[model samples]
Target: MAKLNINVRSFSYKKGIPTDPTGNGGGFVFDCRGILNPGRKEEFKTQTGRDEAVIKYLETETKIALFLEGVFQVIDISIEDYIQRGFENLEINFGCTGGQHRSVYSADTTAKYIENKFPEVQVTVQHVVQEEKNWINEAY
Candidate 1:
């Protein structure tokens, strides 16, 4: 089996509904937005580069790396063991209010992290609610 790194969370909330990782089996899903601050849901009106929200997401991931407690613990166990035993696939999910900004950034960040950490693993970023290219083109 090909080594699979699944990113389940949608790119934006509109399309990025997270499924039960347990149901999918033993793979780990690191929910940067869900576990760290589930209650602080807010809609970002304007996307700012290097904004507080983005910083928060990055901070959350870093924190998870340090302790490996809570939800992150599960991922740590799965990936570490899988790497040892020569496992084929792994899955990760990052969720946020809209999935567009925070979740997308988180997923991308995590994917890059893992790939660099483990060169053998294949990483894929699946955006749930992909923005329309036309809209972006029009805006630009």
Candidate 2:
């Protein structure tokens, strides 16, 4: 069986999309900008999507669950096919205003979802804005 490498990412639309490190040019890009932003709220301004408060705001106050349902359905189809086809690389990107809240939330959740659904798949997550800050792996 071919090992499927799924590179999940969060990026800022303003800063542009994250490039595929695997050099496979085509993959999924889901825009998170359409959802209500928590950043506009003073409480969530400094918090990343990984933060409990930001996660709560996004999960309870916005349409993030619905949006992710659609995204997961789409990606699920492709992942099943990719595994069978022995394809090796897949990239999924979520973009929003700052790449701090919405995009990050989606990417992290999607990575976890993919991990649970496709046990053999190798999932890596990157927060581009956070990476630029040199704090990629930390729970910020």
Candidate 3:
């Protein structure tokens, strides 16, 4: 059993995501920013976003096979190197425009993917921009 962590801010940028495994390295951190739709009219602050058709296409059964293949390429290289190390953590970041809809959705999707693939590992989602602890505390 091992531990892998993925951090996704949104499907907009890859500021926090990590590059693919280069062997003898840590786990993976998928950049979900590619999945975000910039919106019809580019605004400084707003949630006009959507997933690109290309991304949806890649997630399909056929493409997912290839996608997973690439993901596993890193995983395999990492696992072989780190299995003896005991544990590994992958932090994936999904960033979108407003960090509400697309980012949240991508994070959930990535977490789900990790859970399905590595059932023994722990998967967690952290909605940094959208999750407002301040608001919750104020309301309480």
Q: Largest lDDT belongs to which candidate? A: 2
lDDT of 3 by residue, 1-140 (tens): 55544333343342343343324343444533344233322341243213344234335522334443465566545544444466555555555544544455556655666567666665566666545432121110
TM-score (C-alpha, index-matched) for candidate 3:
0.48
CA lDDT of 49 in candidate 3? Answer: 19
Candidate 1 stretches greater than 4 Å from native: 1-26, 34-74, 131-140
* Residue pairs clashing, model 2: none
Task: Find the number of clashing residue pairs for candidate 3.
Answer: 16
lDDT of 1 by residue, 25-129 (tens): 645444445434322334333442125764565466445344223544456567777767767666676655545455555566566666776677766767554
Higher-scoring candidate on lDDT, 2 or 3: 2
lDDT of all the models against the reference? 0.51, 0.91, 0.46
lDDT of 2 by residue, 65-139 (tens): 999999999999999999999999999999998888999999999999999989999999999997797644333
- Model 3 score (lDDT): 0.46
